[model samples]
Target chain A: MVHADSSRFAAGMSTKEVYAQVLEQARTLFDGQRNWVCNFSNTAALLWHAYHSLPAPSNAVNWSGFYFTNPSNPRQLILGPFQGQVACQSIAYGRGVCGKAADTKVTQLVEDVEKFPGHIACDGASKSEIVVPIVKDGKVVAIIDIDCAELNGFTSEDQAALEELAQLLAESCDF
Target chain B: MVHADSSRFAAGMSTKEVYAQVLEQARTLFDGQRNWVCNFSNTAALLWHAYHSLPAPSNAVNWSGFYFTNPSNPRQLILGPFQGQVACQSIAYGRGVCGKAADTKVTQLVEDVEKFPGHIACDGASKSEIVVPIVKDGKVVAIIDIDCAELNGFTSEDQAALEELAQLLAESCDF
Candidate 1:
């Protein structure tokens, strides 16, 4: 059980810190899993699990599930492992935040729920969200997504750190 | 035209050098093009153009022409841009070198002609070639291909440089 102070993993931490923390935590959490690299599915599962176990965690953030799509249906991302209430299992590319992130491969960190165009309300209370593209061999393979129940929850540091972690996953994992 | 010392862009150059020179020269060659991204289609075009322009370039390198497929049709890489007499436009995703690279985002650098499995002989003289994936988001969207008329023509540096160039394109362009 490797634990870092919650303050160190705050929204506005530096890019280096955010990435280092995710990788460091992931390594600690999944070190025993027998795989060269864990896919987005596994990462999401771990994040959900961590969110649930953390003390004084908010209810608005649903840390319950993840999803992926096969090459035959590249346009959609299907649900994978998750922890809170059940979520919409499928999202089309270009539809919601998930879709837009998949289409552009650029991170989208939205501070307000109402401002986002085509915001998919899996949890209506989710006020802020951060979505990062998982790139492998120069193309987007999947995405790392975090949603906050509170408004203005994410920062540039969060975005940078998640992007680095995404890059590391891309290099090490197959999917 | 921005003519590089052809020797600087030699067959044995590192992957980084290959990427830098290709981009540098390409920028000069196609100065005003809006999208400078490389794909299987455009990469094939680059090889075709290079084969025709460079003096006494190896005849054994048979990048004379190539094709790629849209995801809708997995049967082949449809007839794309090329510069040679005979070319195969469509190839199954599991069939030839191009298909294999598409299947796995890993770079395939072939040194000897006869040793390669599924060597699609568009031209029998092609003794060596290198294929690097052009990734966007996390998927392999295209491949940067280099073929030499001579045996064992590509090196690790060439692979690394081209991979770096591929990364740069993925970061800089929206393809």
Candidate 2:
């Protein structure tokens, strides 16, 4: 009975059919939805309205978000569930590029952010970025941030479709 | 120099000139930015992209966000900065209608969340709601939840223009 009918995910599809219908509507709107803030607030509003009609430089996605690790600041990184603008709420673990992708767990393809050296502009028109980390079981439970205004806006098929939607949000939220 | 240029707060105004140019662009993008999570992440992306071109039973805004007070449960409320959909992360201090607008600090105009009795659906196509509260020195800092699919869809001129943008975000952020 998976039917929250988001108009059956419509809108001029094809960016690989909108990330394959946004990873099959984030596994039917998050299987078993164990409330990680309501499955990261409906998976950050289904990746900010499914990359707003993907065509040009990945449809110029201004920003899309998530950033976790607040078991009382596990080395820092708060601000979770987002859409866009006004950010930089925590990020300390290693410092920038979302604390070096949460201290190198992996996935940071930052195409520009003015040559990413401790880049934390937050949104001075975020020119390009991508950070994915959601490694449960062994740890690192969340991290998926995306920003773009243009310059080299993300792709290796948008980082293998956001690392398979961050491994189905680290096996269906509950972080 | 207030140049955070959110495309000069675009969109064809009117709704009292887009809430008086979104309270003068949230006081020039939050005057003297004291950083309450970057001024509620650019005042919830300037009221979810400035009410997306108003006029559809008041531009059917599905949601816009912010909900603070949870530094290890300071009476509860664990979700801040939002856009739409997944919600209800934490809410105690009086519960629902964003904890009675943070325990009656004020502003909870529900034109109809199927008759707000303890209404906490999160987002089943949110029928109508508005909850201002961002007190400051006198207390209760943070809470601006807006949602609408239609039904009465907010007015008292959007509760006195979001209670004057929640008294200018409780006198400009840094909560």
Candidate 3:
């Protein structure tokens, strides 16, 4: 039973349990809230705190955020709401992890960012990352990006849950 | 000297010195960039990391973020980029601390949010808060909000620096 005023969630829950709660809370939070700014902002906060509430490498996550297709420049992605250190403000459509997701319209589960070609190292502590594109009408509208301090921090479970979240976002948000 | 990719600043600096760097960084970050989302996102990031790099009460800050006037619903402000737990998605104009600042178009440096009438407690840990409205053409387009974990955590100096930042936001960003 989470309160509306507090972002705190039950700690020590399994990662799957946490992700499930995130989706549940997101549904409740997104109820009647069609604004992308509000939805993405809260989602970033939820993912950031959710990962921190987990154990071991999950807790080592250093970034959780979103990058939206720049309305000003459809060829690039602009920074959206996020909970992390300052990041690159914009990434070209086909460059970097976020851009790759945006360009390919595919989820990128990078086990080690250093090994990924053309990786943009925004935070030195970020060793691993996963990016999921929020596609709308067969086009990439936005991307959810999470970074961890440890290599191989995200699992296939994360990708699956986030892909589900992307679907919900596509349907729920009026972006 | 701090690197462009790293949000980490010099840790031993005074609050004033840190704020100075924040402004400098803001100028540089905002250089030729007019997108409000990118500007606000980076500004929140700078403020969050700047406070964290400081000493004592400054480092005790828990929330740093922004809220923008919703175009679809001009009577309310929607959440923006932030580096803290999830916050209230929307606050009607003239309602809470943020709204008071938005309505009054004045800097609100509340030492005790509990005593402030209509204080919206998004984070229970927030004891003090500073909200500065960014006015554009005689209307508030957005606001810069920061929350601290300790009572009386902010000083007159904080208000001055934030007000200055507000002016910069008005000039540097196109909302």
Candidate 4:
């Protein structure tokens, strides 16, 4: 069942209002369901829905989803449930944008995929991307990756808000 | 391992070239993978990445994904793997844009979401959307739904190309 309360956010809202609401929604949704899969699934959907509906730069969001550390292989990150196209099955540590984020436990804010050295062109159309690691007990358990059609699509606000959401997920959900 | 052949499509290319290449890539990627999840997953990712990277209009794509008929509940469309934000988990027959497309077995190219009556406000930022039903054996199997941040984001070419891709999926992948 989908959330019937679609009026939670308006289309004309600023990026800050939209993201703040998204984070709030994440907390509410995640609190009710502490499972990692359920939480990530709903959170991804929330992020996608909010960003696409928000005003520009945030409205330019094309891809909003997650990739988690492959339990079978600790050093690799496997595709978790996401909302976009067929992505790479697994990414090794320090390999691509996701890999670097996982390795360093730092968010990688890529302004342009074309300029990012050794960028993994999983989706050729993704011009810019941001990968935020969900750190649990000082270890990155998963990453939230968002792609946009426009270069420099993400701003400091996006980073701060997403990082806050990542912290919330790490604290609340068991991944 | 990810696809290392990033030189196949250049950023400066035309939308037609990018979309054509995306279709080709879909074919190659879906060759041995007939599972619906694999096909839809890759297809959504492919569309999201390609459309975002393409020149404006097409590059304005914010959400590119699918909705398939729920096996347990045939009259409804269950959310499938997608590339955008959180979407309606289940849509009844003849309801919103996706439901109408699935119900009528016709493509719905909505130039403006605001004008489309009964428009399900899943993503407020989506100004325009296109839904193409994937018919298999005279029955509606699935629908490819793409949303854009700008109004009138989809052109006739997008419709034709996506319909073709939908047909390919209908024939090649098993739900």
Error of 1 at A104 (Å): 0.5
Report how far residue A21 has shifted in candidate 4, in Å.
8.0
- Categorize the docking of model 3: medium
Task: Summarize candidate 2's per-residue lDDT along B1-175 as a digit string, tens digits.
Answer: 2223452445566788888877877787665445565567667777777776677766788778877776555787766667765555567878878889898888888888888887877667878888888888887877888888888888798889888888888887665
lDDT of 2: 0.74
Candidate 4 C-alpha lDDT tens digits along B1-175:
2442321456787878887888888787767656565567667777877887777777788778888786657798866667655656667989989999999999999999899879997777788999999999999989999999899999899999999999999988876
What tens digits encode model 2's per-residue C-alpha lDDT throughout A1-175?
Answer: 2233431347678777877877776776666445565566557667777787666677688778777776755777776667765465567877778778877878898889888887877667778889888888877767888888888888798899898888888888767
Query: Candidate 1 chain A: minimum summed lDDT over ten consecutive residues — where?
Result: A1-10
Tens digits of per-residue lDDT, candidate 3, A63-169, equal: 89899998867889988888888788788998988989999999999999999999988777889999999999988989999999999999999999999999988
Task: Report the Cα lDDT for residue B82, model 1.
Answer: 33
Cα-based lDDT at residue A35, candidate 3: 87
lDDT of 4 by residue, A1-175 (tens): 2352332467688888888888877766655445565467667777877877776676777667888886657788766657654567567988889999999998999999889878888777789999999999998899999988789988788899999999999998865
What's the DockQ for every one of the candidates? 0.01, 0.10, 0.57, 0.17
Specify the highest-DockQ model's number: 3
Best by lDDT: 3
Q: List the candidate numbers ranked by DockQ, top first.
A: 3, 4, 2, 1
Give all candidates' CA lDDT scores: 0.53, 0.74, 0.87, 0.78
- What candidate 3 gets wrong by more than 4 Å, as runs, is A1-6, B1-6
Question: Between prediction 2 and prediction 4, which has the larger DockQ?
Answer: 4
RMSD of 4: 7.0
State the lDDT at B173 in candidate 3. Answer: 82
